[model samples]
Target: MPLGVVIRRQPGVTRWAKWVWRAVAVLPGAASADWQELRREGEAVEYHAATLPLTVYRSETEAYRIVLAAESPSVFVVLHPSEEASPDRPYVVHSVTVSAHEAQQALDSGEELVEPVPMPPPLYAWLADFVDRHHADETFMKRKRGPAVEMQSEDGKGDARIRQAADVYRSPASRRKGELH
Candidate 1:
């Protein structure tokens, strides 16, 4: 089950203030709540969203591990367009996650204005359970290369007999030319 978190932000006052993102509150497991307007410009209404359900799956265990191992483990609250497709309420909560690196990358890439908040214990436990259920341990098998062949083919040219395209692709000259060998 996905639990919801209400993310709140206060509007910036100075000119440079708009560039910074701050989280006011994170209400966990909230069913529903009132919508607060974020900003207004020429009748364009943007609302601050409450209650974004943070979800995780077993398939994301590796990603969760990376997130948890980060120096600053945090939950990111992302904003997006509303579900009903209304011009008035242009923004809503898109997703929330514990991946601090992902959140920083999203900000750096200009994907969205994400708010990073500290993950509460309950929410962390919830995500841990999801990952535990969905995560699978994958085993890797070492691949053995074919037995060493005579460097010199039947012909004294020292070049491999061109039986397939891979021969040309794996040629030293081709490899030097930046082809994958």
Candidate 2:
């Protein structure tokens, strides 16, 4: 499905960051948009940054299931600082994904910003249908424990081979100091 990324730019509160760029929403099955200005209110402005393909894989239905199970199901928008970044628009839309793990991976990079935009109704329905068709619960197989070892009761007798003259409960470090081997 074609996904359109909508980025919002607003004046930053801190001096360190002059402008804040964040992904506010996504347009599903939207036509190709290239930095198209959508709305403006005072200093805040929203842009249709890019239109990218949102692919749903059969293998990743489980990840999608986890995404849908959330209280507020959302699509994660990945944004990265552009090379030609300016005071007005510094970040660019990188990608959009439903997989929480993938979003986490993007976040772990420490370079890209990940924003979770609420899943639109049509997109949610599409994802639900896809998951219903492809998703299958994986059966958990519990492994049995191996045969237990018969533990010997040799309390206070440190190493049966070594004979202690002074302290019976001498620490292993103290014993190592005296012994050459």
Candidate 3:
């Protein structure tokens, strides 16, 4: 049986919209019947896979937080090619994660479908636990520049000796443009 995560969404208002997000529950032990189908293409299809509430750790992204605060919380669902035999199509996704980065990596592999869906919550309690375990308040670090290298020899001049080179800098008119090319 395909595993499922039941997410419940609470109704509310936020400064950015008529609805606010709350992860009210998480049933990790859910059955396939519990997941909602989001979209499908040809033989491939995508499901709610799981409810993983995403979080951003660095403090500098307040604007990002504002955007999140204004919107509903969501989960990333990853699709994989189904193992079962299909006449035309090849795959389906049955897994999910709360990490958008991971979902995107799966999608970028060009082998499966992935999506982000607004989590309806049974997520509240689990969300708290998720936060407690994964939460991070990170600080941004600026990259330091490496030491610059001298373009020439230590004497500040090129050391090569071209004893036999003809005038390579001669005017180009003598050589046909096509030949030069």
Candidate 4:
């Protein structure tokens, strides 16, 4: 499915960063856009950043279900720092995904910014259909433990086999106190 990322650029609170960019919303089945200005208010500007394909995989239906079950079902948009960043644009839309896990991986990188855009109504329906058709219930299998091996316990002693000394628990400092110079 084709998805458009809507980014809002606002004046930064800090002097270092002149402007801050964030993904505000996503447009499902939206036409191609390239930093097209959508709206302007005061110093804040909203742009249709880019249109990227939202791909769903059968194996990732569980992740999709987790996202869909949320109170506000969201599609995660990943943005990476653009090497060719100008004063106007600093980040590039990397990808869009329905799987929360995939989005989480992108977030864990710390380098990329992951924005959760509310899932569109039509996109939600399409995702629900895809999950319903491809998702399979996986059975949980309890892991069996191997036969327990009896081992010797040296409860107040630190491996007696290493040293048969009676003051095994005593510190080396104590031994030094009793030593003759």
For 1-181, candidate 2 gives per-residue lDDT tens digits of 9999999989899999778788999999999988899999999999999998898899999899999999999999998888896765677778899998898899998999999999999999999999999988889999999887655434346666766564566555455445543
TM values, all candidates = 0.53, 0.77, 0.43, 0.77
Candidate 3 lDDT, tens digit per residue, 1-181?
Answer: 1235433332335665433222223344455452465445453344443543234454324333332343666555555655874522233445655544566578889976665556545543454444555546667999999888754334312335533223344334444444432
- Clash pairs for candidate 2: none
Q: Worst ten-residue run, lDDT, model 3?
A: 18-27
Clashing pairs in 4: none
TM-score of 1: 0.53
TM-score of 2: 0.77
Best by the lDDT measure: 4
Which scores higher on TM-score, 3 or 4?
A: 4
- Residue-by-residue lDDT tens digits, candidate 4, 27-132: 9889999999999999999999999998889999999999999999999999999899787888899999999899889989899999998988999999999999
Q: Which ten residues in a row have the lowest lDDT in candidate 1?
A: 1-10
Better of 2 and 3 by lDDT: 2
Cα-based RMSD of the predictions, in order?
9.4, 6.5, 13.0, 6.9
